[model samples]
Target: MLTPDALGVATASTVKTLKVEAPAARSAGIKVKSVEELVEKLKNEAKVI
Candidate 1:
């Protein structure tokens, strides 16, 4: 009869496991009085500019 080892089939014992974690959510954001303030925050805090 054919054996599992001879067939090279992967089982739960042969598979690797990992401990994953979820990232933290961003804040609700602050209100800006003008376009300049928004740009400043995007450049300094968000760094997306």
Candidate 2:
């Protein structure tokens, strides 16, 4: 997982433009702290697994 600090460093070293789009809903702010959590969310909440 790329932490904010790591992302910052990567962006600083890159020459290409990067675009970030905000979540369309407030629930998007929900944080998944690990890959297992993310997969669980995708499977249960999103039902896309």
Candidate 3:
């Protein structure tokens, strides 16, 4: 995770580049069963909601 200071410096830099990558899906199948379940997990576990 980027610190606040590091994020500020990165934002101020003239050269801007963004890269995003997704991990390969597990062979066991989907982790969360459904969208609602996923949202619930995010809210309860991740506290992202």
Candidate 4:
């Protein structure tokens, strides 16, 4: 994961132009069959809350 300090350092050293995009207004609509499956994936796959 990129922390704020790391991001700042990277931006300071970068010479190329960086384009930031705005977030989408709507959700991507990903579907899961069950809450248990979502919890398992979060714990073992994506590893994020």
Candidate 5:
């Protein structure tokens, strides 16, 4: 398992972006292709990444 802060999450913008789209992120696709699957995708499927 990965630590909560292993990634650069020590900023306000990062936190906002996380919560803003975490409600409905996708499991696969270019929108969120981190492979780590840490970020939650939104339903809209917009280009936030």
Candidate 6:
């Protein structure tokens, strides 16, 4: 019989890392700053004022 502990010890596969395919969907390059800067940018640059 093979147990999880025995397999982990035998194969050293206990650790894993997750990957994100689309950084753009995750908003990778969106720069943000303080509340003042955000308000200013929203008002002036993004024209959400």
Task: Give me the candidate number with maximum lDDT.
Answer: 1
TM-score of each: 0.42, 0.41, 0.38, 0.37, 0.15, 0.36
Candidate 1 residue-wise lDDT, 1-49, digit = tens: 9887789986547656677788899879679999999999999999999
In the range 1-49, model 3's lDDT, one tens digit per residue, is 8787866655455875687689978767459879999999889988999
The C-alpha stretches of model 3 lying farther than 4 A from their native spots are 1-30
- Residues forming the 10-long window of minimal summed lDDT in candidate 2: 8-17
RMSD of each: 6.2, 14.6, 13.4, 12.8, 17.9, 8.2
Q: Give one digit per residue, the lDDT tens place, for model 5 in 1-49.
A: 6655888556445434334434666587454567444344442344366
lDDT of 1: 0.87
What is the per-residue lDDT of model 6 for residues 1-49, given as tens digits with 9 covering 90 to 100?
A: 9897867766556777787575545545566778898899989998988
The parts of candidate 6 lying over 4 Å away from their true place are: 1-29
Q: What's the distance in Å from true for residue 31, model 2?
A: 1.2
Tell me which of candidates 4 and 6 scores higher on lDDT. 4
The Cα local distance difference test for each model comes to: 0.87, 0.81, 0.80, 0.80, 0.51, 0.77
- Candidate closest to the true structure, highest TM-score: 1
Residue-pair clashes per prediction, in order, are 0, 0, 0, 0, 4, 0
Q: Which pairs clash in model 1?
A: none
Which ranges of candidate 5 are over 4 A from the true structure? 11-49
In model 3, which residue pairs have backbone atoms overlapping below 3 Å? none
Query: Which candidate, 1 or 2, would have the higher TM-score against the true structure?
Result: 1
